[model samples]
Target chain A: MEKGILETLVGVLARPTSTIRSICQQRPIGWAIIVYLVASLVSTIVWIETGFYDLEGMGLPDVGMPTIIVGSIIFNIVILVVFTALSHLAASLLGGKGGYGGLFSSFGFASLPGIFVAPLAVVGMLPMVGALLSGLGNFGVLIWSLALYILAVRENYLVSTGRAILILLLPTVVLLVLSGLLVGLLLLSV
Target chain B: MSRSKIIALIIGVVIVVSLIVLFFGQEIVPPHPRVAIITLTGPIQGSDGGLPFPDTAITPELVRGLLEQAEGDRSIKAVVLRIDSPGGMIAASQEIGDMIKEFEKPIVVSMGDQVTSGGYYISAHADMIIAQAGTITGSIGVIFTHLNVDGLLEKLGIEMETVTGGEHKDMFVTPLTPERRYLIQRITDAAHDQFIHTVAEGRDLPISEVRELATGELFIGRQALELGLVDRLGGRQVAINVAAELAGIQEWVVIELAPPVPSLFDLFLGGGSILREMAIARLLGDEITLLRTLLKTYSLPRY
Candidate 1:
């Protein structure tokens, strides 16, 4: 039983290395490009409708809400191009076999889980109860991140989990730092 | 770029644009919690998903809701009940006060222009009760008011056409006769006893010590702080800064939950009443701070 467990563990770790290499062989950096493009687009659109685009002269350009609406489209397309370019390049380099249909659908897949958060946010509409629910709900992103990484490096789910978690930390941490800096600036201004 | 490449780019752009519309429809503007807020809006007993009212008078259930919110959230490490109420039902104040004590969090009280009677009773237990310089806090005791038209009608007026399980069931809205005054005082005294007990427990003093301060005096924010009624005289920013300092977190996320629904009645009030909206802002804003302040207080309840 112990020997079998050891084999399973080895397979889990080694599986991702092969899967990643194979995907890379098919096309280089395909997953990273898609993730960046989709995330940026989604974030932009969410912010704009939230009247975040109205936060002009507060630091960012005080873009008109309608203009922001239009910009969301443009920005999303920008992300789609850059992200797709990166992914296609990775796939081509790595010899992974996938079509544009799969690639595009894969982008859609990344966003599907985000809607689950709406229900939690709905509960969060309560006072403290709602806030707690929303916090837990937001953690769903971690789940989605894991899925995305595993989808890219499909061989060993365990290894994919680790890699996805580690790689995605880059963007999340950067966002945190950026928020921290913004907070500091606001504090200084105050 | 080739024609196919251009076409692919256009298609990608179109998809991004469409997705953007869906995304914008749900805009993700970040929340800014300006101050310490505890929401007490809505009927103390809520209805279904219909529009909730903020103007509904304060109730004990509302106080209970505030306490529970203050107790559970980590962001609310410290609290200042920004009360602008005339007071609420008798049982509500007492039970909410009880819940307030069970809270291990530091609570300060800030009375707006009108914290009186039962409002003052509830405020009595806070660590410090701060009232605006002109803020009125304390009717110093309890008294129930009712229009006694029974005798007025008996004199050529009609009586409140009614029946009751007990003689006192129609106590309120009945004539305040001498006998009725005694009865009302007796009822008020019982509730008053509970109120004073809360004061004593909250102040960490003997009932006698609380009684000493019960000369039915009301003080403003600065004076309240001096008299141990409130800790300081300040607004939302001060409360939030205090909580932040206490929590020892410089870079933590501060989240404030928005109200679930809007009031349709608010439409009749002419949507933009600055003063009323400011009050609403205070209530909703404080809950977020309570969440920060009560971090350890709400670590985990067994049940």
Candidate 2:
């Protein structure tokens, strides 16, 4: 039997390998969307409370709080879709046999780590040790989320851990090489 | 449940509890006695539905809201009104000026780059006014501009026909007659007298002395100090110190009262209006924009 949403969420952190495999087999797109929505809502709330979206201090027109909240939620959802598509494409090029729905579901579940942002933001509000603790906590959460993402790719694509990491890094490597070549050509022309 | 699952569940519960606390933990604690700073920048006008721009225009409603906030808060001992404007509507300025005079707490005005005409009209009523050495101020007069575009319309081969209930109803659209000019001049003179009286009363100067300086001539902060138009020659820090001194507070914090956050509906509607204005301005070219501004400016009596 397929596990429920709550069980699957806890399972992702507790037993990632099996949970991710179950997620691939189930392909619960609706639940995946709900997960992304919750993560985005949490992110928006933290940003608003912490005044992270206020641009007036930088001498720019303030895109008001409502705009920031709505814009961030939409942007985050778009990023999830775009990131999944790119990762799936890269995995396909690397002789992987994962389907799109399985990869998307796993990637969506990976966003569970972002829920810790709320607690970390509260720590960030402390007077002296707040900044350091918040920074380290956020870094840890980011690494945790990245690990989940790698595992998602590995389990869904039926690939080794090394191949999954390589697939994820493929886009970045190509962009860097393209940028380097462009700079060299500009210098030669000059 | 397994050990790892139990740990994850505990962590999840802790996160939810923290989120609830963060959202609902706002309890107003009595703060240290502080001097609240309310900044008034840009042209003074009526409220524009509370749009969040970089440099928000000064409005009587905005000032009143901030003043009410300061008055209600027991911790706020005094207020520093930091003003940066080239003046605006006469009625709006008078409304703010009246509020300043009636405020129970000590209030100080800190002049910025150019606080002239209606700007000075409002600042004159503060308990004390401080300005930088080169701050432009003291344009204590009223002005009314009448634009006659009939000749321009004729040149463009466009004649305007008007139906009016009164003779002067169409006076603005046509060339000003001698009688209309005298009538307009009298109104301006009355407003000018009112400006002079306000400055004299607030500055504790004689009517004749204030009248002599009310020639619509601008004065720098040093000249204003020498002429008794301003009490002190200094910056915002000096104004804050004077406010603190007047309030008789030794140890006090400084609080800046920012505008209220805009709602979602306000964001969508106000943002649409701003975009519409920008689009019109871009499509109409610079000259049309300037003409529209001039028409808006001259449509009413101003200080």
Top lDDT hit: 2
Q: Per-residue CA lDDT of candidate 1, range B1-303, in tens? A: 554445445545654554544343234432323224553332121121112343454555445545655565534556556667665456556556666556577666656776665666666676555556666655455555444334434654334477788876755555567887787778767776676676666656588866666655665556655555555566655655555555443533343432223333332222333334444446656544343324322221100
Evaluate fnat for each of the predicted models and list the values in order.
0.04, 0.20
lDDT of 2 by residue, B72-175 (tens): 76768999999999988888999999999999999999999999999999999899999999999988888887887656556556666789998788756567
Give the per-prediction TM-score of chain B: 0.59, 0.83
User: A100-190, model 2: which lDDT tens digit per residue?
Assistant: 8998888888888888899998776554566689999999989998899899899999999999999889866776798999757743542
- Model 2 is docked with a DockQ of 0.17
Backbone clash numbers for all candidates listed: 52, 0
- Where model 2 places Cα greater than 4 Å from the true spot, the runs are A1-96, A124-151, A158-190, B1-6, B9-13, B28-40, B45-81, B95-108, B125-128, B197-213, B226-231, B239-290
What are the Cα lDDT values of the candidates?
Answer: 0.49, 0.81
Q: Judge candidate 1 at residue B155 and give its lDDT.
A: 55
Candidate 2, position B210, lDDT: 99
